[model samples]
Target chain A: MRSVRYTPPLWRQWNLVWNFAQRDLKSKFKGSALGWAWSLIVPLATLGIYTVVFSFIFRAEPPDLGNGRDGVFVLFLFAGLTAWTFLASSINGGISGLIGTGALLKKIYFPPYAPVLGAVVAVGVQSLIELGLFLSVLLVLGNVGWSWLLVPVWAAVFTTFTVSLAVIFAVLNVTMRDLAHLVTIALQLLFYATPIIYPLTLVPEHWHSVPLRVLIEWTPFSQFIQVFRGLTYGLDAGSWMSWLTMVAWAALALGIAALVVRRRGGDLGEEL
Target chain B: MSEPAIRVEDLSKVFRLHTERRSSLKEIVVRGRSRRAGSFQALEGVSFEVPRGTTVGLIGHNGSGKSTLLKILAGVYRPTSGGVVVDGRVSALLELGAGFHGELTGRENIYLNGSILGMSRREIESSIQEIIAFAGIGEFIDSPVKVYSSGMYVRLGFAIAVTLDPEILIVDEIIAVGDEEFQRKCFDHLFRLRNQGTTIVLVTHSMGLAAELCDTAVWLDHGHVRAIGPAPEVISEYLGAVNENEALSNDEPGMIRAGLDAVRSGSGEVQVRAVEALDQLGRPLPVVLTNEPLTLRVHFDVKVPVRDVTIGIGFIHENGTGIGGSNTREHGVPIQLEPGVGYIDYTTDRLDLMPANWRMSTAVRSHGHVYDMLEKAFPLPVRSSGGSTEGGAVRIHGRWGAAVQEDSPSTAPSAATP
Candidate 1:
């Protein structure tokens, strides 16, 4: 068998990513006190914190029309957490992924982007677990919708978007150690600036608000929530614009990340 | 007749060294940002080809580009200005345990390291048992590698590598590590590999080892090919060069000349009337193993000197470092002086040595210093091996301690009378 490191065809990039992804997923619980359960626990704790902050401190109540179901609000929050956490963790760790596996980079003659790909894949697995938790909550709360059928599409788009973004960060992290913090904080600001927890309808409508509204919709997290809300709450995507923007962002991120990895891959060892 | 298994042409690699360290802000400013684009030239125009089943040993001093050349051939590092064509599957044990994850279980790491060495996942799975058995890690294979000692580390790495069965194998200095038993096992594996018609490239500093194992050898000096030929011939030239370089600093010119003349005439049963170290100008003096253009001059009035009396200097090492001396008698230098005053000067090009104390011995006889025994001196401090021999080549004049290890010593004091 011929050993490879993307020297053959570009299609092997996916295989390289998958191989490294397995390594990353294996490392997550490889040495933990609770093993794989840690993935489920952190999100459970985070959900509890948000519930206390939003439900008790603010005493925030969802809009009701003589109905005793606040499941919509809960699903909204859960969906946001799922999308945000996956992208944030993957993107944040992706930058330093090479630095973390510095020894491997110098010793092994494989694709340099493997570590970062592995990290994102690990986060993808975590997101799936989180989705399981989210589903159970939806089932218990008794506010379910037929729109859940579209959830997989939304998740796929967002997951792919997150992975592409992570690839870019992993390459950048090789040269800039601080980029890990920079990307995480940038992603955090994105979460607040988007409509993850907030409803878009709450904003005052204005024609001159076109650019602002478009920018908000273009965010992958927002795009995910938009379609997710559409599926769960009987909300329909008003235009095809959100889908185009999400796809365009993913393509662009992937393109640039691939180029960077291809050109300066050999430098990863030196940087590490 | 067939195409060589591995070929390299004009291979050269230049590393841009970044030696300055600045972890803290204060230190960064104190050291100032600096980078020197110094080229190490780990391999320069090093052209060679190895037919199938040929074992070629690379002998060189440290930093002579042996490792770099091996890395490039292993495909771990891309050559800076040349190309290589390898015709078969390659497994390079550049470093053992390089790809193992300490946090992973030893069994898991076996698969991981194997894949890194170009073993497929299926291949690794199939070979896992053999790897464990060969490593002798036993049930500890289930334990995380963080708990492993260095011996275990080498065992696992080597075990995984040996299972790969690559058609072409490139070995760095890995055989120098581990216990002697493990080293012997490695040799057995290499021997089997060669018998199976696998081509191997070995980089080592031991000339004797190369001569024994390699079909041919190459001498690398600072990234350039100094010589390449038969294993024994090339290795002897390298050893001679290494000694001459070391001898240059601590020896004199005249004594080396006289010794050379004495050896040239050939000798038998020669006795020294006078022995002196010489300056670079061939003047007699009292130092041994000095710098370039120097020698050891032995002036002797023979009582019963015969035909072809051999006189030569033999430097003795107590622990892997050379002490200085030369006599025609020991080195097969043939000469005969019938009850006449005569002198022999042994000449050398240079003295490549580090600082250390050692023993020097000189002897003289007939027929290349092998026929009859004569005078020999205690070794004095001549040069250091500079720790380059640390886990490396065996020093000729070195001493070795030995003991018959007891399996279980009888305990008398702790035993109470029955």
Candidate 2:
């Protein structure tokens, strides 16, 4: 006699996603004594190691900032690390998102994409915290300029790219559990393949160097990192072609991932 | 009449059983052929309808497809065949606190669980205090759920579930959690919900609770509907079949019972030859009417000579709750047995048992050791003249009369008259 076909509104579903994202953020460092400070330890140590190795051991000169000032290698590395972590952590968390929320999905019914989106949000927040620290250092060094206004725009572009990849991996991982592990290894390889630890110039300077140069310049990960460094370093910025490449990649990833989710989301509980 | 709240056609579910774990790509590439694993029919052609505003119960043993059916109704698992049409929103408490995180505080978990159940944040905020009050764990709602005891965990989960007030509620054995008082409180809430026109489907092993609460009952045995009808009638039929199964399993060599071959178990030293149920006038009967005096006559024979013999008689409810028993040892009636045929008769003044099926256990022992025992010897059906009062297994006969009280202050001064 009563209708059972009511669908919840999109805003309500988004609120639910927000609640889960909050849980993911709070529970990550729930028991650690140092709390969220623990997250800074690894990146800071990596920055220190890279600065030492490149500046002292390799005797490499730091790059120049926009106003003809020499950029500190650690600051440059920290900028690249923040963008890379945002991209990598979001993908990693998204790949394992459904499996991580297996207990919840098995019992209750909700929008299937909430867990994947929530995981991305958690990592995104953490990346933002790291970005805050990075920006403070840039201000103290007086290296910031008008180009810094594009930081949020860069973050938006990177989030769109990262979340789409995460959703694709997460849905695929449900059917092929090895995909989660395969993705970890693949992302690790992509990290080095893209120019995170080194500048793009590390690749051969020849114009006819098609394969390596294409991977370094045309891939979405490389484009995202280039834009991030452009906003922070305020020089050596990529052309509008790089921004166009990143947006197109994000749209492509989202379209493919959305199709996969529609095909497989309902049956994910059985797979789990 | 209103349309049925749940209409289920020939619903069935099949589960694929993988013979080997082919989760890896290399193994599939190397050794996979058709990839056809075996299949198990967890449910087969289960068809039933639950009318609006009525409580229907599913009663069955373990692995009898009760949980699978409930999951299907709750839309957790898709049916392999047929279909179910539900007219209202369905909520299930399949496993308590399944979505709760151990590290989250109870306050946070409440919102999370509410959102998971499809409630808006505003609705949860409005009903948060009521949920806490129902859970009754003062000051513990602020602590992380990991620190709560098992009882407290289920209490909070149940509290949240019932407060949501879905149109159709399907619960699978969740009431077995928590203490007796909490169980009673949960049942009371369910009863209140039923009164408000909520259609409820309960899957439980407690036949008495089914008989008490449900308007209809479906008995599932081995993924098939064994019987479906009125609650008490179907439960009686199920209990009778269960008793027959126990009788077959308890049958040993050289021990026999009469009137009804129900249950018998023990060595055959002194075999229990037969057991008969009789009315007050001593006429042998297969069934006895409630409130009529009934007698159980146990006939025995001595396969080997036994010295100190004691005879005992007991009544067991169909659900295996022991009612009462009497033994010759407790009565101090010692008998010297040499061998030969003998019978012991245990009579009751009034069979106050409610109208239901029951089992009678008879035994012949020496001192405290059993020489021969007959378990569930007779399948006794106590028929009531009318419907029962629904108190419990037994009915108590007591007089009830009331008189108007005189409003006189001096009446309290007279102890004898008062």
Candidate 3:
């Protein structure tokens, strides 16, 4: 009861988040016939459709790797989609995490951020499974490259931005439920606006649109996808400026989110 | 001598009461201008210290902020202005099984709930078997908790909480659920924990439990600490205040005041307007001692004249045990009824009764038919007059004596003492 800043110890906090993640994952597929196979089904189906449409029907040529493999547009698209799926689902999960667990939070007290962390962790694990499949296919085709080592680094940066946005959206959705729906729509918009499905080079050279270009360049999510692509397919190793911009954007989002949660976290129960 | 386990200084909590819930952005924007209706102050400037290794009871009526105070002590709510200092690991069961995820197995929830209550993984591992045993749901421990019954859920939750072995435990009527055996187990476990130097703060409505279990008691009324002292004294003061309030409300306008009559239900053919208990000297008394002469007067209004109407009066103890009674017809006294206000008195020379609160009732009948009955008219408190210590619903009047007689030949003494 003393006016002290009390928090559970670090290991225990991690355990709590992990326990919740396990519970969420288990319950997600508890009554299903195929169980965890469902996590792989959607992404794989998307990959199959994109491969048939972009490669066969459209006859769009993938960028030349200059190594052995040249025109596998599906592999390149899958690399970027893996990271996007991880970040997108994490952001979406993080946004609804607090509101989803509002019943438990109102009844008892634990660290408010644990649920957001748990949601991120659960989605992260699913994303890893997808990434493993992507890497296995790349290895089977004998196209393994040195640049793939940077996947973890890009993942670290991506997780930072995901956590910040998750915390922000999770807090907002507790008071404003419509924000959850808004965030889902916004994530869909962001997926298309960023260079996940199409290459950044597809932008016309003669276009002088400042806002559109800045949105593509300055957005943390855009940089995350670019960083992931640079590491996986070895097409674009972003310069120091792009790296700094991405790091700055992540730091800014995290700083703002921490401030918001600190100011509004105590009333989470009452608001609910 | 040591520092108290918890010291709360002027603790208060104010809650913003919105006239309508505003969970959406549209509501906030549309009705944003005229929002300042009012707020409710759940607790206001309440202060009490709980010493180490002692059980403190919080007694109050509903909506009296007892649960709010406990939540504040458990750090669930931040006080509006005041502060509290607690000196040990604190665990609170504010809502039983608050952390249980229904999708998880009972065993899994034990670990999850244990960590939520501030236990480490290793600590939960060590106590896992004990917790499972205490829960008593043997195979169901492996099954998801969503399938558990309400009793099983409460039992599992109480078992996990009590086995946490925290230095300080705060409970809010968590044992009020579950079956009687499980409730007894929880109470016994809490009592053992208190004996082992674990400071406990309990919020309960049962004054009997508070007086029997707690070392100190705090009575909360309207968000204020009304009284704080020994358990018996505080409980008595709380019960007295409650009774006084009930009596005042019963005497309010439009509420007919009839003697200990809590239930006024009938066809209303003959209405007993007012009932009173008086002494043999014609003095109305609310309370009388055992073996004291008393009279019960039933005042009624009859709609039509009736003949051979019998008036019966009976005494019932507070524990719902009925004592002996008599009616006018049984005593061969015939009574006539008329359409006017009238009174009938049943008198006793010496009221042989136990030391307890008794309720008096009256009935009107004619020719072995009851016209109307007034059940529980008025309460008469009967106190013992320093005699036998025997316990029962009735007091017996008798004398003890010893008589000697000649022993039979078969029963002659055989052994001798040196």
**Which has the greatest TM-score?**
3
Q: Tens-digit lDDT track for model 3 on B272-319?
A: 776666778787554555677867777889898877778777788898
Ten-residue segment with the worst summed lDDT in candidate 1 chain B? B385-394
TM-score against truth, every candidate? 0.73, 0.81, 0.84
Order of candidates by TM-score, top first? 3, 2, 1
lDDT of 2 by residue, B104-180 (tens): 89989998888778778898999999999988899999998999999999889988887787889888766557778
Question: Mind listing the fnat for each candidate?
Answer: 0.18, 0.43, 0.46
Worst ten in a row by lDDT for model 3 chain B: B252-261
Off by over 4 Å in 2: A1-10, A59-62, A205-210, A235-238, B1-4, B7-10, B44-51, B85-87, B218-310, B314-323, B327-336, B340-393, B398-418
Question: Individual DockQ of the candidates?
Answer: 0.20, 0.45, 0.47
Clash total of candidate 3: 7
Error of 3 at B175 (Å): 4.0
Predicted model with the maximum DockQ? 3
Candidate number with the higher DockQ (1 or 3): 3
Please give, for residues B1-418, the per-residue lDDT of candidate 1 as tens digits.
9888888888777776656533333444676655573546567788888887899998889889888777677766777787788888777777788877777788878766765566667777787888899899888899989899999988988888888897888887555587889888888888899889889999976654576678888889999999998787787678667656656764542232222223322244354544466656776533444334445566666666467655656654556454455555456555556776777776665553332443344565443344323333433334322212233322334588875554545633434457
Q: Is candidate 1 or 2 superior in TM-score? A: 2
Docking tier of model 3: it is acceptable
lDDT per residue for candidate 1 within A90-170, as digits (tens), equals 887676666777877666566666677777877788888887777776666664665566677766777777777787777
Error of 2 at A222 (Å): 0.8
